[model samples]
Target: MPDLLVKLSWSLLCLAHLVPAAALLQPSLLVPLYDVDPASGAGLLLRHRAALFLAVALVCAYAALAPDGRRAAGLVVSVSVVGFLVLYVGAGAPAGALRTVALTDALLLPPLTVAVWSAWRA
Candidate 1:
């Protein structure tokens, strides 16, 4: 059961990242994804951000499938999501499409805590 929780959480992390990663190929996705204009100067940087998210997703998927990889993967995945939420709230939790992203992160917290505890138990 503990192993299951760990794997499930990692898989969820991958799914969360994959959405943003899709913007690497489809820059127009930025509008719905983050309300940024793809034609703006920020396009390049945002695409790069997509790539990074893809890398995270790959690592998370691997961790879900490979027991030996979970610890390191957990560190990477947790820091990414938790770090974003911290920065978001610290930034005053400004309202916008990004707020939805923040909400998503908040929703993931419970499962993330469960996974962490389960991992510790195992």
Candidate 2:
């Protein structure tokens, strides 16, 4: 049988990433998502970020079902989440939606760890 925890974790990651990825097609989402105007440079960069997030989501969806791909998928997801949290904290941890973003990533850490551990044991 497939590992349930891996499936759940990767699936969650896929969905989480897809939310931001949608901003690629719908730039207006940036306003509600991060309060940035779509015409601004930050908005342009955030749109690019959305595309990158789509790539991660694709990888996660694939890995959720493919055992051989789990390690790489987990690494990619972990690095993305952890790197964002670290950078955000280092930047003095500003308030607002970004802090919510960081906290969301922080909350995912435990489940991610459990998934990786279960896979390793298997």
How close is every model to the real structure, measured as TM-score? 0.89, 0.91
lDDT of 1 by residue, 40-113 (tens): 87877888999999998998899788867767777777887899999999999999988998998888787667
Strongest candidate by lDDT: 2
User: Can you list the residue pairs that collide in candidate 1?
Assistant: none
Residue 111 shift from truth in candidate 1, angstroms: 2.6
Best by TM-score: 2
* lDDT for each residue of candidate 2 in 1-122, tens digit (9 for 90 to 100): 34786688878888888988999999999998888998999999999999999998998898888878877877888888889999999999999879878888898787678656655666
Local accuracy by lDDT, each model: 0.83, 0.85
lDDT of 2: 0.85
